[model samples]
Target chain A: MSLLRVENISKSFKTLQVLRDVSLEVNPGERHVIIGPNGAGKTTLFHCITNILPIDSGAVYLDGKEISKLPAHHLAHLGMSRTFQKNNLFGDLTVEENIHLALAAKKPYRYDIFSPLISRTDIRKETNDILEQWEISNRRHVKVKHLSYGEQRLLEVLLAMASNPKILLLDEPTSGMSPAETAQTSEMIQKLPRSVALVVVEHDMDVVFAIADRITVLHHGEVILSGSPDEVRNNEVVKEIYFGGGAKKHA
Target chain B: MKKLLLGVVLLIALVFAMPLVLSDFGINLATEIYIMAIFAMSLGLIMGYAGMVSLGHAGFFGIGAYTVAVIGQHVANTYLLLLLSVVISGLIALVTGAVFIRTSKFYFLMITLAFGQLLYVLFWQLKPWTGGADGMSVSAILNFGFGEIVSPNGFYYVMGIAFIIFYILLRLFVESPAGKITKGIMENEARMSALGYNVRVYKLLAYTLSGALAGLAGALYAYFNVFVSPDLSGWMFSGQVMVMVIIGGVGTLLGPALGASVFIYLQNFMSTYTERWPMVMGALLVALVLAGKGGLIHWLQHGKSLFVARKRTGEAVSQQPVKKGEAVH
Candidate 1:
């Protein structure tokens, strides 16, 4: 069975039908990349899968069990994690503090109010390990807002990874990064261990071909194609949509 | 750690030293400041950390005071009364905050203000139990096993001790993991939810904790003034505490306490000079808040930097002069 299954899910906001019967699946350890034009409802699909936006129709399942109605926060404890299209970091906190909060959220002691988190040696060690693992330990004390845009985006991914999730959803992870930063992020994505499945929404074609084990193409709020990387790259419909050959406007 | 210890030591020393230097009236005012400080600090918690700006905090404060006044008539135990004050207010906060946290920003402020007014009206109308608009005197003496604390000096010391204990408790809470999560929720609620946090729960937690503290402040005030009034629960009082939190600096625990001190001192001292004291107080608070970078705490930081700059200039006089408009560490 697929590790994450997004069954015939459709979402709408008022009159605007953002997603229409979107469906996909990810196997354990699979690198699934989602590519689409700007208005293809990629992020909306991410929201629906994570239960951030309640779907207008259909359902989502994790490990064959339906989770379409579960609260968004419950998705993390259920072995799923995600990043936003935009950097969603704790801007005022230090980088280490942000990591600490992410790690703490998954722990039973997140509700521990009497004891200071700094006194938790276990949490500190884990935070340090994750920070060092990402080579961000050197900038640990700097507040996230002070970090470069690349660093903030990197921290967003680091935080998502802190949960040791079974399936991680990254939404345009390199959206605002410089080219060098994008390459670095791609390298980081590649380096991510296979214990976790990756579902990435990326626009960079170079990064897309380099990392996508399987590719899913979305257009006009529907998946036009889902196949092997080579299959998706050679598809005429994708070529028309992406390479300016299509009669369809940039919707 | 050493700095923390020194700060505590200094606090303890000041608490002991202030009574000796102040007149009887000054001591009384200081004690009132302590009580207001607790209430203001509670508001500061939700405002600064949880990103909740409430305009109905005094409702909890009134609840605390009235709890003591109404319950003390039946229960003589002071400790039990204070505990009841905290629990009752906390539970009320839990229930009310459940509804309040659903609203954000200006709506939140308005909802809280409405809650405060509702309680204020309740107190005003509950004549037999609360003595209505005339208010009721607290007959229950605060007997802590050793002796009854009835004098101004005794109340001053007791309030000071209570304030310190609360300060430490709030400090520990802010440093706790839950507190960190609450701050994160404040910064980015959707992100927090995406990161596996029940954002509403944390917001409610902060609100409940804040309400309990405000209630305790009200209870303490009931004992200090020996009076319970509907004004305690009014929006005006809530608005006053919010101003205290804002002018003191919203984020730091000490900032609100300092803000309370300045506020209470100015109000008390100014009232004696003129009947237009509220106007003066309002003007002062507006000036302090408008000082820019954020409340009085930031101004304190600015002041410290200026002093350091002057000292550095003096030290560097014989050496190479510092570059103009150069960034200091």
Candidate 2:
């Protein structure tokens, strides 16, 4: 069954129509990749799905419930989590502190101001485990401002995953990374729990093909093609838009 | 934690022993300082933690002061007046915060400033209840069922105990999970929201909590000075509290309290030497800004670390070579 379904979602900024009737679906545990060129409305679509941007038309459903009009935080509470294209971290806080906050998001007493956070043994252990799993234990005490760009990106993804969402939306997770860093990030994403579905927007074809269970090619605010990697690779329209002509290429 | 506890104990001891050495005026000044510290600490909760730069905090402060003055006319009980003042101020904050938290950055600042000015005007115009521009004298605080606490020493002890309790509560609040989320919102609001935190709710809570604390301070101020005026609600007072927060250190739990002490001390000292004390205060503030960011507490912490490093170096060079190796890493 589809865990997340975007039905004909459309969004526009002033005169520019960014997402024009774009729709897609993600089955449970599917790694769906949305690949497009610049100005293809991929990020806008993600924003619409996450309710960061109000849609001009159409609706979004999460787990068979309509969530098009819900706020972004509400969507997050309903098992949807997302990372920004740019680094979105608590730059003033320590790495472990950041993870501790993320872990507190879904906890029962997130707003309890009287209880000491350090006294919560379960939360402390979970935070430490996440830091260790992400291999950022050494940098736990360091402020996020001092972290490398690659580390910040990794932390951003780790923060999204900390909420333990049923579906995660990642926008340009590997952007501005070195090849080695990209390879490491791809490995990290590939290792995410199978119970969590992923919808990734990417410009990097290598990472796209590496982790995608199904590929959707977007062009000029519309979905040009949606299929398996091999099918997208063979499509004539996708070939013209991405590779720039009728040149034959191995699938 | 041990150091903090020791400091608290030392502070409590010093406060209890203050009347033995200090004059009546000095004790009165100390009471004012305690009140201002509570006010500044409330601002710190919203400005430092939640990143909501409110310019109308004095509005809540005035609301608290007025609540005390008006209630004191009929009910002479100090505890009941304080409770009513806090509740009334919190309710006002809850109403204002619902609208205020939606705006960001400069807009939030401007709106809060406007709210404060509005209260100032209301206090000035409501002459029947508030005594308008001339202000009203507060009634003596009744000690539960005991006699009135009209003496400076009695008020000093009362304010001191209240300050300690509020400080401990505020400290516990900042160290709690809610406080952690507030700091998270300060650093990155969108990320907190994306993590499923209703950013608005946390901000509202911070706003309301800060308002309640400010109200508590205002109530104490009315009792301490035996006066309530429209000036208490003015933007100048809000600015003063904001300055106190910055001068002490923005995010540190005790920074606001220290800042208030420094500000009040400097004000008193400068006024004794010169009539143009505001200019001297401004110059001193400029000097502080030029010295470094993070205010006086930050410098104090930095200097202490430097001192500790020097002391450790003096004692450890030959005694612990392996420990030095670990320190290098």
Candidate 3:
């Protein structure tokens, strides 16, 4: 059975139709990527799937259960986790604190008056593991606002991972990064547990080609193509519309 | 950990010994300070941590005070009346917070202010129950089941304990995941909503919690002072709470208390020499603003040495960090 399934999802903002009859599916442990030219509504699709925006028409299901109408917070409680195109980690909190909070969201703990946060050994261990994986252990006490830009982006994704989600929704996970940082993020994405199904929206064609098991192409709020990376790269229609006739570069 | 323990011990000692330091005039001043600190703390909960700017905490404060005064005037058992007053004020807060949290920042501030002013007018116009402009007085001080609570010193101890308990409670809330979500909402509501939490419900809960605490302080004031008036609901009173919160460093748990203590002392010390006490307060506020740089709390938390280090490092970097709501895409 598909871990995540979208059925004829459509959405509009004000008078503008943003997504038109979009449908997709990710089977368990599959890595899926959605790509399109600018204004392709990749972000919109992520929003719909994550329940950030109400659909004009359609349904989203997780594990065959309808969740098209669930609120974002409830969806999170239902084990859906997502990262934004932009870094959205808590600025004032330390790196450990941010990860700890994400962990706390997953499980209830003794957060009472007079009790210390340091006493929660399980949370501390979990936070330490995430911090170690993200290579931010040395800067655990550093606030997000004080971190380097690339580090902040990594921290954002790390925070999303700390929630121990079943399915991850990442919107442009490598946005605004240097070439080195982009490569690092790609490696990190590859390093994530394969058991966690992923639905990623990305602009970098190389990154999409490098990791995505399958690609879904959207243009002007409609799916233009859906296939394997080689199939999409060789498609004459995709070349004509998005790739400038395929002369410049190839992933 | 040792330092924190020492600090708590010192605070406890100060609270216990405060009553001995007070003369008759000093006792009244100290009582007002305790009440104002609690009022400021409630405002801190919403404004500091939750990022809601409330300019009408005085309305909740007045509601609490009046509830006690009216009930105390009629009921023979003062303790029961105090308890009832706090409960009633909390109910009002629950209803008001439910409505107020639905709106955005500017709208929230304006609506709360309007509600406060409306309460003020009602307190003035309702001559029979509220005693109109003259105000109303309680028949006697409260008597809890354990013993009679009458002496100014005795009441000081009660206020002191309550402040400590609430301070600890508020600190816990700030550190909780729920509290972190509130902080997140303050940063970006759109992001928070997208993350799946009901932004409105969390904000409303925080506002209600804050209002209940403010009302608790007000109830204490009514019984201690033996009177309640429309002045409690006035815009000026709201402004005072805002000033105290700002001076103390908005989100810091201990900051509001320290700010209130300093403000009360300043008011008491300055009024002895001048009829223009308001003007002195204004000048003092201006001086504080000038010295604040970032904010009083920022200065206090970072300290002068750290500020210098931060400035040096910040200049070396020279790029402005990304602000809230700026998406990478």
Candidate 4:
């Protein structure tokens, strides 16, 4: 059974229709990529599925259960986590502190006021372990605003992953980075355990082809095609709409 | 940790010994200062940690004061009055915060201001209960079925103990998981909400806690002043506490207390020699702004670091100082 199923979702802002009858599905452990031109409603579709922006009409289901009207936070509680297109880090907090907050949100004692955060041995151990796993432990004590841009992006992904979601949605995780940084981030995403399914929206073709198990092309608020990378790379409509005319070979 | 402990111990010693050197009037003034510090610190919790700037905080303060004044006239039970005041203020905050937290920035400020003014008018027009514009005198706090604490020194002791207890509790809270979430919300509410936190619920809790603390201060204020008036809920009073929080230091744990003491003492000292003390106060505030954007606590920290650096180098420190909110990249 599919883990996530979006059935005919539509969204609009006044006369502008951002998403029009978009439908898709992802199985457990599949790395699905959504690619499109600027203003192709890729982000809007992601927002509709996550319920950040209420849909004009349609239904979203997780594990065959309807969850179209649930709030974004409720979706997160149901094992759906996402990263923002823009870096959405708590700038004033340290790296470890950021991971601790994400972990705390999942814990039963998130609202516990009397217990000092430093005294939570379990939370501290988990935070340290995650930081070490991400190889950012040396900068654990530094405020996030002090970290380099690549490191900040890494932290952003790590924060989303800290919740240990069954389904992860990453929106343009490498929007602004050098080619080296982009390759490193793609490698990290590819290394994620198969227990966590991924849905990514990316403009970087190299990263997309490197990490995607399947590709969905969107054009003018509609799905142009959905298939494996080789099929998507060979489709005539996708080639004309996305790659202009001729397909540029990628290494 | 040792230095902090010593500072706390010295502070306690000085508070305990205040009556030995000060006159009766001075002792009463000190008691007022302690109460105001609690008020300021409560506002700090919402504004500093939760990042919700409210302009109607004095409404909660006034509600607490009036609860004591009206109830104590017949009951004279200090403990019951305090409990009622805190609970009632918290309820009022919960109701208002539900509406106010949905709005951002300017809208929040206006709504809170409007709520405060509404309460002020209610207190002014409700002649039977509030004594109308003339205000009402309050009875002394009954000493826990023992006796009345009528002495100024005795009252000062009570106020000092309350201050210490509240300060410690607030400090611990700011270090707790809930407090960390409050800071996270302050930094980015959207991010917190997206991370599966019910942001509004956390904000409402912070608002309610702040109101309860303010109510605690207000209940004490009524007993200390022996009067309750509609002015307690006015916008000016709300502005005064906001200023106290800012002038002391917005996010620091003890900044609000220091701010309250400095503001009250400056007003007292300036009024002694000059009839135009308001102008003098305005000038001092402007000077503080020009000297540095960071308030007194930040200034003290910067100065101490600079002094240490100079002593160690035996030369003039020439590096550009790191500004607040700017990470050392």
Candidate 5:
């Protein structure tokens, strides 16, 4: 069964239709990337799938269970987590504390007001482990606002992964990164464990082609095609629309 | 945490020593400050940690006071009355916060102010129960099994202990996961929500808890003052508690309490010499706001430079020693 399946979902904002019959599926361990131009409704689709925005029609299923009507916050417990296209970090918090909040949300006794978070050695241990694993332990105590833009972007991805979701959505994770940072991020995304399925909305073509096992092309609130990387690369329409005639330029 | 512990110890020391040094009138004033501190700290929790700035906090405080003033007329047990006050105030908060928490920023402030005025009108019109606008004396004696606490010193000690306990509870809560999440919501609600924390539930929880604590303070105030009035729930009183929070600092656990003590002490001190104490208070608040050092508590922590620092004449590292032809922008 697909880990996450959005079937025939449609959305509109005011008089403008934002999504039109967008259907996409991700199997376990699939690296599914969505590539599109600006205003292709890629982010709107992510919002719909994550339940951040209510879907006008059609249902979204996670592990074959309907989740279309679920609250956005509940989606994380159901193994669906996502990052925003824009930075949605806790700027005033230290990097470690930000990670702690993300990991702590998954715990059952988080509402226990009598127990201090500092006394919870288990959570602290996990926070330290994740920070060390990410090779950012030295910067753990630094306020997130002091972090570089690229670092904040990376931290957002780390926070999304903290819940150990079965399916993780990354919305333009490398949107504001420099070329070097983008390549580094692309490499990191490719290295993520296959136990998690990735659904990324990206404008960077190199990142899309590098980390994507399969790609879905979106244009004008519709899914142009969903296929393996080779099929997407050879498709006449995708090449014309995505690459703009023969020359390969970023969309 | 170390600072918090020191604050508690100092508070205890003051509780013991203040009554010895001050007159009965001074003791009475100090006792009122302690109660107001609890009230201010409750509002501080929602404002600083929960990112909810309410202008109707005095409503909960008034609820607590009126509960004791009216209900205590029948039930003389101090514990039962106090519990009733806390529970009723909390329940009201839970119901009201459901709708209030839906609004954010200015809408929240306006709605809370409206709710507070509604309570104020309720207390004013309920002439038989609340004694109307002139207020009613708390007829029940505060007897905690041993004896009636009628002496000013005894009431002072009781309020002092209550303040310390409430502070410790607030400290522990701020260090807890739930409290941390509340702070997170204050900083970034979207992130907390995306991380699977139910933002509204946490918000409502903090709001309810704050209301209950405010009620506790009001209940104690009714006992201390021997009267309950509609002004207790008035927007002016709510605004005063907010000023206390601002004077003390917003986020720190001890800040609001300290702010309350400072405000109450200054109000009493300034009134002795000048009938225009409100003008003095307005000026002080203006200075505090302009200084913007996070409040007096924070200002006191940072070297007390305003009083003790000596001006040092030195060369600025960036100021290139007036290089012969260099133009200074």
Candidate 6:
């Protein structure tokens, strides 16, 4: 059964329509990859799904509960979390602090005054576990602003994991990485637990091929194709816009 | 742990020892310093932690002072008056923040300024109740059951203790995960929004809390001075709090204290001679910001450490390398 369903999602900023009639679904623990060239409204789709931007029209259901109207934080409480296309981590805070914050964000807290989170042992352990899994244990105390580019991407992924969301949205998770770093990130993505459903927007075809259980192709804010990885790889329309139309060369 | 204990002990000792070492004027100046510190901390809570710019802090202060004086005039219990004033000021902040927090930086600043000015005018226009431009005064702080807890020196200790408690509380808050989210809001609001953190709500909460603290300072000031006036609510006073935060260091807890101490001392000593004090203060503020450094407190902590070590121990180690995807600069 599908854990998340997005039906007829459309969004426009001013006169510019970003996402048009985009519908997709992710079954439980399925690794869903969204592939499109630059300006494919891929990031916009993620925004709409995560409720960062209001969709002009759409219906979103998480476990059969319509959640399209919920705000981002409320959606988080409903077990949805997202990472940005641009690596967005708290810069002044240490790596551990960032993860601790995401973990804490999971549990509800009213604007608590005077309570220090440092003393929370459970949150600390969870922060440490995510950092350890991401292989960022050594830089745990380092401020996020000072991390290397590759390391920052990993940290962003780790931050999403820290929230322990049932549905994870990752936008261009490996955009500006070196080949070696890209492989490492792919390896990390491969190791993510099967309990979490993932919707990933990636530009790298190799990484998409490596991890995606299913793929969706978007062009100009509309889903032109959705199928298994092999089907998407062979589609003529996807080839024309995405793989530079020389299907013979790639084949 | 030992160092922290020593710091606390030293602070306490200094607080208690001031009256013994200083003249009456000096004691008065110190009291003003403590009150101003509380005000500055309120600003820092929003400006530094939550990444908001507020220019109407003095409105909260004025409301607080009026609450104390108004309640003192009517009510028998000084403690109850203080509690009531704080609650009223918090409510004002909550209502204002709920609306003001929805706007962006420029709009945020403008809305807060507008609301504060409106409050200032309200106090001015409601002549009989608020005493108009002349303001209100109370004969004494009625302690009720406690019996006459009303003296400047006595209030000094009260205000001082209050400052110490609030400062420590704020420090603890800035280090917590919620505090971390606030800092995150400061650095990357868009990221926070996408990550399921409601940016505006967090900010509004910070503003309300900041205002409540500011109100606490104002209420204390009103009781200490036995006066509440329109001047307390003026935009200039809000600017003063901002200046203090800038001088102390925007984000650091001790920065506001250091900033307020210097500010209150300058005004206390220098105002005795000239009405031109405002110009001098403005010049000093401009010079400080132009230096492109954080307030004196931040410099003292980090700069002094650097000077002593001379980057000798690789002690200058920043926490981590700038994440490759997210360019630091």
Query: What local lDDT does model 5 show for residue A20?
Result: 94
Model 6 lDDT tens row, A107-141: 55525555667667787677767766666777877
Which has the higher DockQ value, candidate number 1 or candidate number 4? 4
Superposed by TM-score, candidate 2 places the C-alpha of residue A52 at a distance from the truth, in angstroms, of 1.0
RMSD of 1: 3.6
At residue B50, candidate 1 shows an lDDT of: 94
Candidate 6 backbone clash number: 10
Per-residue lDDT tens digits for candidate 2, residues A154-200, read 89988898888899999999999999999999989999999899999
lDDT of 3 by residue, B1-329 (tens): 34346656776787778777768677767767877888888898898878889888899889888887776666757667656766777788889888888887899899999988989999999999999999988665667766887877777777777777777677667766667667777876765664556788778878878888888888888878888889999999898888888777777767787778878888789888987887987877788878874346566667865886687667758766533322210
Write the residue-wise lDDT of candidate 5 on B1-329 in tens digits: 66567877987887789888999888888899999999999999999999999999999999999999999989999999999999999999999999999999999999999999999999999998887889999898888898999998889899988988998999889989999999998988877888999999999999999999999999999998898899999999999999999999998867898899889999999999999998988899899989886898787766554443232214335455434322110
Best of the two (1, 3) by TM-score? 1
Worst 10 residues of 4 chain B by lDDT: B320-329
Instruction: Write down the C-alpha DockQ for each prediction.
Output: 0.55, 0.62, 0.21, 0.57, 0.45, 0.41
lDDT of 6 by residue, B225-278 (tens): 888888888898898888999988887777888899988888776788897887
The stretch of ten residues in a row with the least summed lDDT in candidate 3 chain A is A109-118
lDDT of 6 at B273: 87
Clash pairs (backbone) in predicted model 5: none
Which clashing pairs does model 6 show? A146-B320, A146-B321, A146-B322, A147-B321, A147-B322, A147-B323, A148-B324, A149-B323, A149-B324, B248-B255
Candidate 3 collision pairs:
A72-B196, A73-B196, A73-B197
Candidate 4 C-alpha error for residue B40, in Å: 0.5
Interface root-mean-square deviation, each candidate: 3.3, 2.9, 6.1, 2.7, 7.3, 4.4
TM-score head-to-head 2 vs 3, winner:
2
Worst 10 residues of 1 chain B by lDDT: B320-329
> Ten-residue segment with the worst summed lDDT in candidate 3 chain B?
B320-329
Model number with the top DockQ: 2
Interface RMSD of 3: 6.1
User: Model 5 Cα displacement at B295 (Å)?
Assistant: 1.6
Candidate 6 root-mean-square deviation in Å: 4.5
Q: How far does residue B46 in candidate 2 sit from its true spot (Å)?
A: 1.1
